[model samples]
Target: MKTANKPRTSGSGTKRNGAAANGKKMPDVNGPAGDGKRPSLYANVIKQFDKAADMMRLDGNIRKILASTMNEIIVNFPVKMDDGRIEIFRGYRVQHNDVLGPFKGGLRYHPAVNIDEVRALATWMTWKSAIAEIPYGGAKGGIQIDPSRQKYSINELERITRRFTFALGNNIGPEYDIPAPDVNTNPQIMAWIMDTYLQMMPPHERQRCIHVVTGKPIKSGGSLGRDKATGQGVVYLIERWAEEQGFDLDGSTYIVQGFGNVGSWAARLMKPHGAKMVAVEDVAGALYNPEGIDPDDLIAYAKEHSDIFGYPDAKPIDHMAFMGTKADIFIPAALESQITALTAPMLKVRLVAEGANGPTDPDGDRILLERGIHLIPDILCNSGGVIVSYFEWLQNKRSEFWDLDEVDAKLKKKIVSAYERVQGVAHHYKTDWRNAAYIVALTRLENVYKERGIFP
Candidate 1:
């Protein structure tokens, strides 16, 4: 598949200075802010990219092209609420790169959604696709609305999603750009977007456009294992890490931050391997049980109560206590910048497998590195969703369906292969796994640019 080559204005000059192109003085990566003010997400992502690019001596032209997004689209559309009120919603879609193939990412609905966050997510998607060896680039988008709030009913959400899709129009397409479920989004939301996009096309074109958005309900063309793909991928990489270290997963204890789809699924899957969940945290509150909490029970409670705060099997604990809970592994499936200078020193785990994008800031990374903590970077660790989304896309495009066993088998193969590649690069460079993952991704992107060259 091919997309129209869109020229983006270069954000970087020929000079390879450490400072950002926007004139903000670059902070010392080793030492983050002491005042606890986290840097911009986009700046942090750029710092990671620059480190890999410099380490590998990436081509200057490719560096310049990737320094900024190829397209930053913001749409403000009005939606009529169920209460007979018209509310204007702001949405964003940032296409970071498309050198590999079509743009692919997720659409999230949260009040905190902003341009910088969207850009950072889009940039991460680029690395994730490259790391997974998928034929896709990166793009992320979201609307500034709190889906969890009770003010917006289901009907309101559908209208808002449909109107946002209408506003995006051709910016998203089956072969050009595809959106999937992200934070505060589910298969139902994706189905709305897919239906909205299809309605915009004629009957003949509608059939071909079902692949425009993935993570839909299975009846609506979603893959069998799409819901748990990210969590399963995280567990797969963790299993590989255990094998390399000669550590047994059976009887190991783990703690998870964020009891969302990724966290819950990971906990449940790891249970079959004899791993135990000692603590779980979410937006509502945190829960701890030294004797091990049952993931199945906790998930059911969370579904009914909206979070894992009041699970009867576990006691309520504060965030600091949750972090300090001693466990064999820590899975941060929450928002970005959660583990910074303040929180990094509190983690009691030996390994951190990032289930969410950009969970660790640079300072946190340095602290973990200094403390001899092992990490499975988010780009490589949480890539199962996108990898399977690619499968769902293929299925839709070919009018074929895959069973759960087939999807799970294919996902494991791709994720394990990517994990091995990252491990190999880490060994070759003698760098931390995070940096090695970035290098692996950048190497692929750099080589593609070298072979393809810039268009005339």
Candidate 2:
């Protein structure tokens, strides 16, 4: 698959420092206060890219490609609410790169969705796939409709998804752009997209196109072990890191910030490793227990109680308190920017593993590095989703499926290997983990671009 290449131009030559060419404005990104408000998400992303580019002494041309997204689509559409009122929703999709292959990422739904967030996320996806050594580029889409506010029935959501999919037209395809699940979206949502795409295609061409969307239900051709892939991958990386550090998992305490799919599954996986989960925080509330909460029991309780609070055997705690709780490892499995400078200094953990994209802001990350916290960068740490999504896409295209055990084994091997590689890069660069990860990904992307060369 190929996309039209856009010519690169130097953006304000006066800002032509190695980092500046990467489109990062240091003064604008020094902190959330630099702008008198939170730093722009896209700016924060570019700042990191710039830091990495500066470290690598990357050429301007490659920096340009890495710094900017290849394509961005915005759509405004109306959906009939349950009250029979038509509500307008804004949606966005960003394809960051296609140098490796087609763009692959997830679609999110939230009231806070915007073009800047999508672009930043798409750029992260590009780095993520590159870091994982996956044969794919990066893209992301989101609709700015609060799923909670949508009192519409399932039919309305399906209609909204189909309409948005149609607006994408040829922009998204099995061989062009593929989207899975992200914030406020899930496999059911993906299935809606696939069904809509299939309905739009000629009947005979449908079978060849089912691979266009991933993260579907297993009955709908989703890959086995897909649901737990991301969390399991985190555990896999933790084990590898533990082995390298000569730390025992048994009796080690962990605190997970966010009791969502990634956090819950990670907690469950750690249970079998003999690791104790000391605290877990969710949108509703948080719970803590120094003796360790049994994940199985906690999960059951959360399901029954509708939140983490009020669960028997665990004391209810404030959200901020969970951040400062002492633990061997801390996993931010929640939204981006949750671990800002204000929160980082309070974290009493030695190891920080990101289960969400950009969970640590630039200032927060610097503070963590200063304090000698070993952070598993999000790109490498949470890449199991894309890796397994790649497998699911391949299976759909080939009409073959692997069993759960096979999928688990492959996911473990891939994540563990990537972890080792990133660890080596960190040591070689004598830098913190996030910068080390960026170095590894930038090197791979640069080599590919150099070999491919520019085309007329």
| Model number with the top TM-score | 2
After the best TM-score superposition of candidate 2, give how far the Cα of residue 312 lies from its true spot, in angstroms: 1.9
- Candidate 2 lDDT over 112-169, as tens digits, reads 6666677788888898888888889999988866565335577778878888887777
lDDT of 2: 0.84
Each model's C-alpha lDDT? 0.87, 0.84
Clash count (model 2, backbone only): 0
Candidate 1's displacement at residue 66, Å, is: 0.6
Q: TM-score of each candidate? A: 0.86, 0.87
Top lDDT: which candidate number? Answer: 1
Q: List the residue pairs that clash in candidate 2.
A: none
lDDT (0-100) at residue 117 of candidate 2?
73
List runs of model 1 lying over 4 Å from the truth: 1-40, 78-88, 146-153
Worst 10 residues of 1 by lDDT: 1-10
